[model samples]
Target: MKKLIFFLLLLLAGFNLMAQQDGGTYRAQLPEITMDSTSSLHIISPEPIRYVDISSHAVAGDLPEENVLRLKWVPDSTGNLSSGADNLGVVTVIGQTFIAQYQLLSAAATPGSKLAASYDILPQHIRPLHLPVEISTPQLRSHALSLLARRNPSAIRTAKQYGISAELNHVYTLGDLILLDITYHNSTNLGYDIDELRFKIEDKKITKATNVQSVEIRPIWQLYPIGSFKRSYRNIYVLKKATFPASKILSVELSEKQISGRTIILKIKYRDILEADNF
Candidate 1:
């Protein structure tokens, strides 16, 4: 009977050891960062951070820009910082287009490595598994402007009203985003004070007067600021990936401020989106 009990205990011990080894495989392999009780470490990210996961033993928070995280080690009951992997904690920082994991240890507890005040999360350190997030807003605008600079071989779509012309020069697709190169020309001498640039999916033919339904879609990013422009104005706008049937059309509406008398609307068909070029 005693032998049977000892065998059962040995089997449970082996199972626990195997579980610990399996779990350790998924831990961060990078060398642990040292944090001392005297100063904090500033970790900068490439883009705006969306989430941060840190250990309870350390206190961490984002700055005003939300792209930098300041982390500091907490002192234990003995008035000393924690040391080693078991005593310290792990930090996982997630941004729009990047992710990094760090193991933090106390400088006072570990004497080998030097104390660094700040760390930059570079592109090479980004985790490969989580690459589906969207790029920064500035990058999207820059890409759109680059497309605008090039000449377009595709047919141009335009809408003209009150000596103001709105043209759709090109459409490009990236992942789940749609980039559009649009231009406006003011033939009249007066400057056009822009009020609002609206995008909507509406019916091609508004037959019923009582039930006119349209879905307003805002751009995820705009290349230019919304204000007055003289002569000619060229810019880019980005919207989320969407689909509409033949019965509906994507409308780009530009209206003048205050008076609201001068307005131009450009219609984009579903086929145009389907035949968009990949950037």
Candidate 2:
């Protein structure tokens, strides 16, 4: 009876030791990233990883926001990667689980390439995950300029509508003297007084004033239709020349209010030459 009791106690001890070894918990190990443009590489541990809390480093300046850490597999020879994500500093394992996946991006390899990665582990907040990858130079060249131009169609339409027209006659430099030769015609049969003539340059409202000199005008026909009767007036206004450092755009807008109707015309011109240095 005593021997049997001792044997049963030893069996129970062995069972407890085995259970401690298989503690029902394990951490997924980081996998080696291999460079292969033909296939995507993935590392997955059974544990669920949360990406929202991961720390990320962004390149300085105005960069395209779309390319920010969206799972890109760059070639191994592309030098220092522009951006990467840092692991969330710590990972908790409830049970035995491990999973990870890396999707590749289509880009050619330059010299000195590397794979940028982010791994989330505990204690240290964010950690940079990097792995050496091998890549081969691509044989085919791609034309990206046409693709970029196609993406921005609105700019093309605006250029076509508001671009320089052939009606511009004078070539003026920045800070140069210029003269505005404006002509106004009274197209209505009944005599009407001109209230104001407003000139706007470069989208800026310049001046609005009445005619200071006295003027007389007579209608040729009783009631002038399109080409029936005629009345014309001309004014010379002096403008100080201005220079733009680079190629600048100048827009001229004319606003006239008469007894009959109000008319407005806008003209845009590009100035490439500099006329004056002093402001």
Candidate 3:
């Protein structure tokens, strides 16, 4: 049941792309980003980047993947927004030179400053899953206990959708990743299992002025066993942090893993991101 999801959605290079949506004039707080192959976006500005709004277009550009490159915010490894994670950074995927435009609401860049981004393609390939020999079962249980004990929930941020309730536990931004802590609860009799789950986002609007095509966010993490009560786990283990378009109505859709038709939508407000960042 868990294996088929990788092939569920056709990774059509640039399918369902919205026409060039006007992102309006965006200011580059940091004049130049050291665009490299790695998925991290390096900005010189120290300001919080949650306010940065960006949209990517699938154009017939000079790159191999005309629709190959996509941008996402790199979430902290621990899913805690503040710990060793970046709330204000952008990361690109598929290592291609595509067109991405963004803007900051409160900051302005020096005149003639061009916003630049690049991805140096690495040896990207899907390898067989391997578990190291040094780890013991006792160690695994100890680690799980540590994750279960995480107690950071920003009292101000909380949301419930698809029978799942999430409270913003903790978030810290760093130079590399943004740490995030979230406690999830399933109110129904059905069990929560990633082997059969799916996550997607529809960009109804980016900020008050921008728009983007809908995208499927893949491979979420599960901390405890299925049907655990009020259990919280930072999804940093299996999921990479992502940058979402600063959309006004960011719809996070979750569907039953085994039964795709049974789904739920969480309308994440713009305030959700900002408030989490502020916390």
Candidate 4:
């Protein structure tokens, strides 16, 4: 019995030793992007497009802290985050509003090297509520100069400022149309496609037909392309002037899609409502 017990203990010890020697740090998957062997920018997401078996892969979840998963800054190459092939890209994979970018600077991009092998791979931003809407640019521009300004931004309002900057430009109320001009600037070097855009009112306690029939831009609008670094978009809505009271809240809700993770609601104060020609 002693001899059998000793043999079983030796067997377990050998298995444990093998397990320690078997797995080292993960050999991270190489990014599809390639830069000037010197340096380049990238954008990625760890959310797999296809189902991944986490048991076998060393993904961002398996990694501790932000060490191996995040990008490393190479200080010797460039002065800013763009240089040194070392300054890694910032990863902000927003499902609703943004698709941030990342970077890969290769000291000398060798397939097996550490620097060139890593980059960001983001999942496709999903949006469910897409409205069927189109704009007539000719008519839109024609009405711009003559239209009565209901509300124009005195100072730029910043909606979301991390990876993307959304600014409110102008708001005009024509005879039967409301024109909204918004500029979205992408600060990240990577590109993200705007999945879905929706326009609606948040008034839930309304019991009157007057408020319902007031301003009419609902359930249909788009904000140019979310992919562009700097895009100025216009939402020409058919709207009528309701009550230009001393103050009011127009919930201008704009977002990526179903995900409420990033939503912007601009409560417009119609101080300019008094500036209308009718007044």
Candidate 5:
């Protein structure tokens, strides 16, 4: 009976030890960061900070910019916030695309006139939660403008409808994106009110009564914001780089607001996409 009681006690102790070890591994091992109560620490992120989890030992506030975070530590009267990891505070900064974690360590104040340290959260540091890669909107717009300046031969894929001419001027490849330069020439006096500008992949030939099967492609970005234009107008559109069968065709359809409801479609072939110039 005495031996059985001792064995039961030992089993309980083993379970308790395992539980503590599991708890320690629950939180990720974060990067260690050092700061002192005598100074301020600033952290900046490339994207806006959507959520922040901070410890109670420190006071944190956001600056005017949504991407910046300010942190300051407050110590006890003895000028010490224990050296143990349990007493230490942590900071977790989350963005739309990535997450960052830092373990704050209390350090002796450096000899200076109230020092301030800044840290930037770069793309290479964080784990991308949802996005595969970081994309810059401004860079895309700038590159699109540069492509528009290039000289290309007269367009072979074009269509005319009611005095309006739609032309697919050039196709360029940038990274995983396809940039297209489209120009609309209005010879008539009437300005064109654009109702819709759409892209799609459709069958090259349609039967008399068969249902038309088409897949619409949405542009990731476009250069212009105008609703109406006169004379000659040119714009750049961006789409994800893709491929289609030779029997399929890429179509750019432009429609005007109803009343006159003028419409034009510019068809591009798979061979044209294969010949896209690199930007």
Candidate 6:
């Protein structure tokens, strides 16, 4: 009888140990959020939620601190806490326990005029993953601009000495579809083929206006002495019709290639149209 009793006690202890090892607990603490406000509710979990099994749902009963897992207010039909037309509330959980805080936008002076909020607790199992890499033009453009702006004049002179010349110019908009004349001079020894040139306009008030090409001209060079090789190249870029704001940034990039050392020049002119404001 003594042996049997001792065996039964040992079995009970083993069962209790197994039960404790198989179960886990959690608690959640949430902050408050108001309507029309950029606020975030913080959720704190006692134990890392990542350890929980993905197939199982973590409920309030599974939490170690069940008393703290109460909703701050009765939720409305849309699962939101509202005093009238405003939504101000949040729910957060730490481990297996959760706490919800509702923001009081208006006075709940009248009886039964309190905000109601409700939500279903969801089981979350997050997995770590890597994202694929992709190129972004805007990021590249910003980096390139920063690099160009910080370049020293010595670098520009070296490029000029290598028969490469770069120029920065702008087009000012006058009244009605009229543009002022623009000019670019290349003091390099090598001629470059204009690969591509782009223009960005900075204006906020201007409306849609068609880009018109007016004139493009290049100067010719008669073969003379080694020091007297004056050559010029020019063209007018006709832009598509487009509307623009009063404040904007116009960017133009030109590319070129040449065999013989020569300087290149460019001239551009255009017209912009605006709608007649009839107040």
- How high is each candidate's TM-score? 0.62, 0.23, 0.32, 0.33, 0.56, 0.21
Cα lDDT tens digits for candidate 2, 1-279: 999999999999999999888834222333322232333323222222323221122111121221122223334533443334322122221211222332223233422245434323222222323422111111000111122223222211111111111122222222233433333345455433444433333332334563223122221111111221135443333344443322224443332334344443434333322321121
Q: Rank the candidates by lDDT, best first.
A: 1, 5, 4, 3, 6, 2
Report clashes for each candidate as comma-separated counts. Answer: 0, 31, 35, 13, 0, 41
Name the runs in model 1 displaced over 4 angstroms: 1-43, 56-60, 63-91, 102-119, 131-146, 153-155, 187-195, 207-210, 222-228, 256-262
* Among all candidates shown, the one with the greatest lDDT: 1
Tens digit of lDDT per residue, candidate 3, span 1-279?
A: 555654454433224333244434333432223222223333321111212233322111222222233343332322333322123343222211122332311111222233344433323211122332233233434444454576654443566766777554544332222334445567766666543233445665456565556666553333344333333323422233456656534444434456534454545544554444411
lDDT for model 5, please: 0.78
Poorest stretch of ten by lDDT in candidate 2: 133-142
- Model 4, 1-279: lDDT tens digits are 999999999999999999989843222322323333333333333321211122211112223221123333234423433333442322333322223233223333344344344454444332222332233333454555333243654534456644665555665554544555555555656443455444433443457564653343452222233332234444433344555444344555555433423444555555543344320
Worst 10 residues of 4 by lDDT: 50-59
> Which TM-score value belongs to model 1?
0.62
Among all candidates shown, the one with the greatest TM-score: 1
Colliding pairs, model 1: none
- Mind sharing the TM-score for model 2? 0.23
> What would the TM-score be for candidate 4 when compared with the true structure?
0.33
lDDT of all predictions: 0.79, 0.30, 0.38, 0.41, 0.78, 0.32
Report the number of backbone clashes for model 1: 0
Better of 1 and 6 by lDDT: 1
Write the residue-wise lDDT of candidate 1 on 111-143 in tens digits.
Answer: 434667889987766774455657675488568
Residue range 98-158, candidate 5, lDDT tens digits:
8887777665544434343878886665776775553555577788888787786889588
Instruction: Point out the higher-scoring one by TM-score: 1 or 5.
Output: 1
Model 5 quality (TM-score): 0.56
Candidate 3 deviant stretches above 4 angstroms: 1-148, 152-163, 193-201, 204-212, 217-245, 248-251, 259-261, 267-279
Whole-model lDDT for model 3 versus the true structure? 0.38
The Cα RMSD in angstroms, rounded to one decimal, for candidate 1 relative to the true structure is 7.5
Cand. 6 Cα-lDDT: 0.32
